[model samples]
Target: MGSSSRRNTMSDVTIIGLGPMGSTLARTLLKNGTNVTVWNRTREKAEQLIREGAEFNPEAAAAVSASPIVIVCVANYEASHNILGSHEVAKNLEGRLVVELSTGTPQDARNSETRVREQGADYLDGAILATPAQIGMPDTPIFLSGSEAAFRRSEPVLKILAGNLIYMGEAVGAASAWDLATLATTFGAMFGFFHGSRILESEGYRVDSFGSMMADISPVLGQMIKYEGEIIQTGAYENPQSSVKTCRGTADLWLKQALEAGINNEFPTFAMGLFNKAKAAGYENEELAAVMKVLR
Candidate 1:
């Protein structure tokens, strides 16, 4: 095998794509004293990093061949495939590790893992839960999944790019699945907040005060998350105390007001649907946790 031209060193890393996130990763690696080689479809995008002591490669295959750990942060799975799927590049990737930080579905991540494994390379699917600015910070959360060996081998490099690095087991698809689900939930809540704030603004209510109230009440969502597990596991919605019917009625009234205030009720409407379904399922006297039945 002619000694497999790719070099493996604790300080060697290569990054494909030079978008904000990709560029940030490159800079972080470089700042941490890692030798970084970067490539982008548009060559000029790598200019900034070049000035930061990063080696710029004009060819994608050469970039992949430059290091043991190759990180890709492209636009999508297809773009990721385009760079790593080439015959020459794939052959050169043998015994190397590919860490994909691209935004994609679980299926996409799994499929990429399969392809990379076929090339005798290691694959790790990663999801960055923070923005570009958060890269290299201590609190940036990066979810990783794939082979345990691959994850452990690349931990040092990955840590340079994230504040908090989490391993989500060995299934490459797990990270992507969890990432997408979390993204949907976060955006849903933000959209609901925006709708409420706009309605209050229209009625001459101070948006700042509403924002403060939301900040204070946001902890309740965390409580709901903690209680959700108990509700699901025991199938017990006994709010011991509170009645589901009362909660349902209150939610319905809230939804109606949302609609009447010229605010979009889609968010609250969706919640109401679940609440109503649970109530109809003979859980009216149960606690609000009974709504899990509808959610399930």
Candidate 2:
């Protein structure tokens, strides 16, 4: 590690892969006084960092061996395996801490965890939730899951990389599972807003006002999330603040509105169907989150 805020040519960390995300990770560390050793198949992708005092390793194994703490953010699980699954790379990875901050499936993380552990490496799998520009920002987060030992060893450096560091659990796939679930939530909300905006635009209504309305939704959403968390953990969705049947009433109104507007009602229809499923199972009095049971 460099100074609390001083990075130089002698990097304390090695970063494998210089794709947009990887390169940004390296530069963010460099800017925050953490020297980085970088490697990429395309030598030129690391030119800027090389000038910023990052050691350019032409070989993947060499990059893996450069520092005790190595971070990988590559194209995919296959590419990750191709780069580090070789015997040549494995030889240098003994007792090393490898944090994979790449977009991959839960199974991908589990597979990589097994392979790296077999080679005597400490593995931590992660999913970055922010874009390249948000790498070192205060609110940017990345979900992490792996051995507790691996996570503890990487925490200091990781905190320098991201403002919010969420440690999911020892299950290597936990982080990816949460990442996908979060994405579903994100896209679901976005899709609803997109459809609403389009529907309004189609009828010469202003969509700009919806932005402020959505901001107001943020807190309501936080409360919903908190309520659901308790409900799920208890496994007793009984006596909800707002019962499934009650929400279904609003869901019905939404479906009718979408129909009247000639807008696609699929989203509302799908939600109503879920509510109906819970009601059919005689859970109409439980919290809306009770529908998760049917989901399983």
Candidate 3:
């Protein structure tokens, strides 16, 4: 039988808060043939999942208690606390696995782990790196961190949700820290790309034509990221293939071009500022990875 057809023997999962991501999680689970119980403050939000064979519980405690693993994806840690930490809910969570997937500060993740552990429940804190639309795909990265015991128990279900399930060790905040770092890069790339596109548009160039050139960046970004991992982790910024000086020259050209095009140079200028700072710190001759040291 296919995996979904044999879901009856698999561990049941409960999803709390039928927000966009939460609802997506519930639907993914149901579609893949997993027994699911879902709860949301607004009953209408979970109506679809309910109709799709997911058990809909009006009471949060009932939803949580129905499954071995209860996943909470809400506004943030505060909202999760208010819902899960309630007397009725808290009392029922003992010995269960609580997976917190809400985005929050590392401190929030740590605090939630402590509070949930105090309630006699095993906790795993997670940060989903993909959009809700990408939730069930294998290639989506999900960073999870917490006690090893808790992780071992949840691994099977996690694998079902993500192709890339990164367990960030036993520290509760590691997943959140990595999640924030990933978001920083993602947001930076977003702004940086748009800034350049705008600069081109200002020069009477078609944005559609610029897209073909933009597609060429994938390999460059991939290589840089791979090199950064090898270089930064070992603190080896020496004997450069591409020196900081060369990169700064490129960034300066970008900043100057943006300025000459009468477009906002803020994005390129900000990047140039970093390159300038790195050069000023005497890393001009070092590999471009040395810029990371200045950032530190």
Candidate 4:
């Protein structure tokens, strides 16, 4: 801790990396009356925030020392390591809380925690589930996992950026794990939508209308996913409302349609391959979720 006068002048938090997301975080915190200290590799990037009443620290080590909580929103773990991995800067981490918002693997999170803790600092691995524009909103989500005590200490400040805080317990890697899993689910649907759009285009139908329809019936789609997850979790693949054979029929139809329309069939081909594996395993008559068995 610094002297009384120095502490009085210090910001509540120091934000590293002045990228769009980092700038948004600083702006949001300033908007909410939280004193903010900002730093970036490019000094020009900190100019706008300085005009908005943010204090600019030219050095990464000094910037981190200016606040009790430091939030690093850089490009990735590699960039983060390049900045804070230095012995000089890492030394300044003592008696502070470090929140890493950079995206990386679960192992990255674990390694980050080890490094920060080795410097006598508390660390929280965080994953922002919302976009820059979504920051500071009450419903905007952020997932965090780390030392429970550290999380408790940082919760109020973290909630200032994202009110919907999902604390995934003390496992530092949990936040990144959840982020990657959610990304997989989201991108998988996006790829499916790409193929679906092709299907609509092939039929001379409006793809935007199909998207609107998906939005309208998203709850029903969500329910189907939930049911399948339950089936997979419970290892229950019997008495299916929709069997593997029936689901495979839809994949066949997609492939047939794609062939007839002279369109790409990559998505359907992938699905057919999985379903075919299940069929080979004698699960054609089982629930659609039995595909997991083949996958496992």
Backbone clashes under 3 angstroms, per model: 1, 0, 1, 0
Candidate 1: what lDDT? 0.84
Q: Supply candidate 1's per-residue lDDT for 65.
A: 80
lDDT of each: 0.84, 0.86, 0.86, 0.92
Ten contiguous residues minimizing lDDT sum, candidate 2: 1-10
List per-candidate RMSD values in Å: 4.1, 3.9, 4.1, 2.8
Q: Write the per-residue lDDT of candidate 2 for residues 88-144, one digit (tens) a residue.
A: 898999978999987889999999999998999999999999889888877889999
lDDT of 4 by residue, 84-169 (tens): 88877898999999999999999999999998899999999999999999999999999999999989998988999999999999
Question: For this target, which candidate reaches the highest lDDT against the unseen true structure?
Answer: 4
Model 4 bad stretches (over 4 Å): 1-8
Compared with the true structure, model 4 gives a TM-score of 0.95
Candidate 2, which segments miss by more than 4 Å at Cα?
A: 1-10
Alpha carbon deviation, residue 50, candidate 2 (Å): 2.0
Q: After superposition, how far is residue 201 of candidate 3 from its true place, in Å?
A: 1.7
Ranking by lDDT: 4, 3, 2, 1
Cα lDDT, model 4, residue 13: 95
